[model samples]
Target: MKADRIVSVIFILIALVFWSQTFGLQYNCSIFPHLILIFLILSSAIMFAQTFFAKDIKREHLSGKDLKYIIISIAIVFVWIYMLDFLGFIVSSVICLSILTLILDQKRPMPVRTLSSVAIYTLMVLVFWFIFHKFLLVPLPTGYLI
Candidate 1:
């Protein structure tokens, strides 16, 4: 199968799984996920259909280094998720976002740039936390350091 088709199928499956889980949530909590899942499924289905009609698609092989980075990125995300309960959403998000940004940037890291990135991530995380925890009245994972 083509890569696009495979990705679409995978996303469709993921959407279905999440869709099922959403039923257990209260109506207010489930609404956003339902909308997002619907978008995911529709976009993936559209991509799958386009893959069938499109010809001469170029396939690029991932290099070993690129594959290594991808694997590491996935591992980092898993670790971030695991850390959330212990570190809280804000701390975990800032740490993970900074690490991910550093990993993806190929240029030599400067002290100023690193600090700026950390500050930016911190601000972003705080904004999101405020929106969800304060404005939306949604409870986020809280731990010792929050």
Candidate 2:
């Protein structure tokens, strides 16, 4: 049981759990989730299968700094989700995406670069907002900011 196999197996189990829960959803509501879950299961299954045939399996150990980064990123994601209802999708997404970009970025944070990064994230969020809220007629979580 290599790392890839273990991760794929875990994803498959998680997908199975979500798949079961989708049964209670309305047909229309469940369709997207089902499609995504099916994709997850298929990809994980393929990865699991590939793990066996993969040669020269090099297991890289996570350093303390990398582990810290992972923990921080996960915490940021949780905070972003929690903020969505209060700050709305656009505000929360832009803020969180900016933070994530700053954290993951290794380059020196110049003023123009940081601003551009934020602008890019804002544009991306707005595009998604328009697609889901306007184009698809799907109501997104709205708050004071949006």
- Top TM-score: which candidate number? 2
Can you tell me which runs of candidate 1 are displaced by over 4 Å? 1-34
* Candidate 2: residue pairs that collide: none
Cand. 2 Cα-lDDT = 0.93
The per-model lDDT (C-alpha) reads 0.93, 0.93
lDDT of 2 by residue, 13-76 (tens): 9999999999899999999999999999999999999888878566789999999999999999
Q: Tell me the TM-score of model 1.
A: 0.72
Report residue 22 deviation for candidate 2 (angstroms): 6.7
lDDT of 1 by residue, 63-131 (tens): 999998899899999999999999999999999989998998899999999999999999999999999
What TM-score would every model get versus the actual structure? 0.72, 0.75
The RMSD (Cα, Å) of candidate 1 is: 3.4
